[model samples]
Target: MNYKLIVVMLFLVMGALVEGKRLANLGHKLKQEAEKVGKEAGHILEGKVAQKAADVVFNAVLRKG
Candidate 1:
């Protein structure tokens, strides 16, 4: 009876550990996707700002440098 209880407990603990690992993996994947989206957004905003800056500087210069 004691041995049976021990075996059941081990299985329960293992199942819980596996579930935790799966949750962690899902969270990691979501974070990676979010970071990728953030990077793309940053690039788009940077491109717009760079273009505007170039236009401003070009207008300021009396002659092309």
Candidate 2:
């Protein structure tokens, strides 16, 4: 019974780790896309205010961790 419980716990931990990794990857992709869009928008707009707005979005999409 104890060995079975340990095995189950191990599986749970592994699953959690996999999910965390997937989420991290997703976040990275989101940031990359946001940056690309932000840059494109800034170029298209061609104004200080628009560039500032794009900068705001780019910074907001960045993760601190």
Which ten-residue region of model 1 has the weakest summed lDDT? Answer: 56-65
lDDT values, one for every candidate: 0.97, 0.92
lDDT per residue as tens, model 2, 1-65: 69999999999999999999999999999999999999998877788777899898888889542
Runs off by more than 4 Å, candidate 1: 58-65
Give the residue spans of candidate 2 off by over 4 A.
47-65
For 1-65, candidate 1 gives per-residue lDDT tens digits of 69999999999999999999999999999999999999999999999999999999988895765
